[model samples]
Target chain A: MRRGLILLGALLALAACQQTPAPRQALFVVLPGDDGHIGAITVNDGKREILLDRPYAASESRGGVTAPVQTSEVEVRQVFGAALAARPILPVHFRLYFQTGSDRLTPESDAAYRAVFDDIRRRPVYQVEVVGHTDTTGVAARNQDLSQQRAASMRDRLVRDGIAAGAITTAGRGELDQAVPTARGVDEPRNRRVEVTVR
Target chain B: MHKFVWAGVATLALAGLAGPAMAAGAVIGQVKTVAGQAFVLRDGGRVAARPGDAVQEKDVLETGADGAIGVTFIDNSVFSSGPNSQVSLEEFSFDSSNFKGAMTSEVRRGTLTVVSGDIARSTPGSMKVKTPTAIMGVRGTTFAVQVKP
Candidate 1:
């Protein structure tokens, strides 16, 4: 019995000698959302779990999981500057109105067009989707053609503004999707508009 | 024309094997920005990545020592990675009408930045990132991850 205990102790000592501290293999940092809302991240390393709920909260794993820690913005910038710099801007949505029975833009929509164009131009790369909508003022078949014309016209305007024609796609949804639900033959300014989404 | 036809056939075959999240070559995202040497590995082929390139599920995004890349998903989620990185879009599905979906991405190595979009915002715990050591459940947040070799 004594010899067996001695052998077991020797095995334990040998096992201890073979172990070396493991290096940190990963790092995770939680940041705030665009609207300044701080969300949470639940991290599981199989053995333990961490909930990072605050901005700049961080966690790292070595051989074993570590407790959550509060990191600084400076550290994040220094460590993840390249990844952050590569992040693309979120999408933007714009609406432009049109005159009744015509593809011409209203005066107010014409004024709003500048900002939309500027926003698209400011991005390094963008994809524009122009969807034309019409009010329930005319027959569905004619309205479909009219909406298509409005969409094509808007696409032409963007092309004229120097935006690449290949980067923009246009679609027309006739009185099917009215901004304001209206009875047949009713003209709704809100529905007679083109929506542009830039990404 | 021949290449396009073969590609469609291959996509259809892979879609059958990829389960539900992938449906006959659906475009899940687009490459918004790329610098230096970035590439997308899809279906056993590695091609240089460029802005405006379509990104599909099961694609592996890789960056060289001097490279960086950014991708924007249909759900509005954004993912960017620094040099010497390998990230795989394991699974993704989005419903435009409801703006709800589930996504899972795995970072094999290097640095990654994630901005959760409608998927995580509309349904918490539906978006996740997997690393060598841990799995993170993102709840409509922006976050950074680094994996060392």
Candidate 2:
């Protein structure tokens, strides 16, 4: 019985020695708004000091709306690290407002778009999808057209900045797909936005 | 005698006007194939069509409206057209009858996709889709057409 106990203890030690540690992954999150209000970005990774508080300048207007300036490559890497650590790198959807029936980027969204551009540029193997959506206000047909135009405009901007055009696919879901639902004739600010996904 | 002659003339004019009106032509089919507007009939026939062409029976047809419409063909091909798209099916046909036919269509503007079925395969090279800038030939498969006007 003592020999058996010693054997069992030895087996346990061997098993413990063979155990592997989980991989170290990182995650970062940033929320930028149109009202010149840039939300706090947090990065959680051991051995890496990411400055998430960098201020992105506001730049040219899209569809008569000023979009926030583009984010740098360093910031994008931090965010990508965070996203990869949290989950499978599926596309994340965010809202960007535009002028009604126009493809111009708003001032607030410029910075976010820049960040997105930076992120896509850093990852060459990844593909980007830009889907535009609109609230239910006008005719469904017109809404679909407008939404598509907006999505295409955004895609053009990305391509101009050096991303391969083939890697991007733009779709206008129209009012048929809504991120936020509201009453009829009610213009929801959140609803009139573009959703971008990096896959 | 003069009044009698005038009444007969009026009757003849009325008959001529009513004859054609009763059988007004409809867009039988439209060209939605590839590279150009073309359609094939069920009996293994084909036609070349262009954008803004009227869709009629006996003509393979497709359409794009400001709204949505569900389209089905004799060969069981289904297609959906989004708003503001210009679509037309120009040809349609079955191959079990000896594989002799052609289909064609055109997209002036907008977006559309075809969910090709047995008909597309049975009739290879028989399907053609035309956009404003390019002509697409289908090799027994499904594809999409988007034209920016």
Q: What are the root-mean-square deviations of the candidates from the true structure over C-alphas?
A: 8.7, 26.1
TM-score on B-chain, cand. 2: 0.54
> Highest TM-score, which number?
1
| Candidate 2 residue lDDT tens string, A79-102 | 222221211122234567886656
Off by over 4 Å in 2: A1-91, B1-149
Q: Docking category for candidate 2?
A: incorrect
Candidate 2 chain B weakest lDDT stretch, 10 residues: B29-38
A95-182 per-residue lDDT for model 1 (tens digits): 9999998999999999999988998998878888788889998799999988889889999999998999988888888888787899
Model 1 TM-score on a 0 to 1 scale: 0.76
